[model samples]
Target: MKLERKHALVLLAIAAWNVLTYLRFIKALVDTEDRPTGYYVAHTILIVVNLLIAALLGTWGVRAYKASKASQNAQV
Candidate 1:
């Protein structure tokens, strides 16, 4: 399916939000005390997975947006 400008924007927004929010979460996680080893391990894995997802989304969004603009320019 073709990704419209709006879809690209949404994906970019989600990617940005995930990066910003998860960075803050990492700081909080570091500052917290007395967490079990398993807790930190699980959360670290979660953060890694989410960050990977964000990277993928950001890449897709950027490529789609650039393609849309290029197509528009070509039509002119």
Candidate 2:
């Protein structure tokens, strides 16, 4: 299914937002040095959670966009 310009733009914006928001967690995980094992573990968990959320959001957005496009095509 084809996404219109506006739909594509919105998807792009959401993806960008997801990446930007999660980047801090990733940076923390990467940049921290001489930390305790528990500290690393906590950051790892946070990063995993962030990735899961982003994946879920991306999947939902793609499915919704495709469904809308399919419905529009059917009506035409």
Candidate 3:
């Protein structure tokens, strides 16, 4: 498959994981009966922020991979 196709597949997977994981996190936050102390809210927010960072890194990886492949093909 082409680099673009691979990137698209990876992006799709990441999007799916992002949506599903965020839904779970939101559910945990809203379902808590103890009225969500500060720590619990902070932790949930941290988890979300971390996942978003990971997603950004994954996007960078895809871009790097494509650029490298293009350079190699140009040299060939």
Between prediction 2 and prediction 3, the one with superior lDDT is: 2
Task: Identify the runs in model 3 with alpha carbons over 4 angstroms from their true place.
Answer: 1-36
Best by TM-score: 1
Q: Candidate 3: lDDT over CA atoms?
A: 0.70
Q: What is the TM-score of each candidate against the true structure?
A: 0.95, 0.69, 0.53
In terms of lDDT, the poorest run of 10 residues in model 2 is 1-10
Worst 10 residues of 1 by lDDT: 66-75
| Alpha carbon deviation, residue 36, candidate 1 (Å) | 0.8
- True-vs-predicted CA distance for residue 39, candidate 2, Å: 1.0
- Which structure among the candidates has the greatest lDDT? 1
For residue 53, give model 3's deviation from the true position in Å.
Answer: 0.4
lDDT of 2 by residue, 1-76 (tens): 6555467547656766777877876876788799899988887877778677777766666776777778779889
lDDT of each: 0.93, 0.73, 0.70
Which run of 10 residues does model 3 get worst, by summed lDDT?
1-10
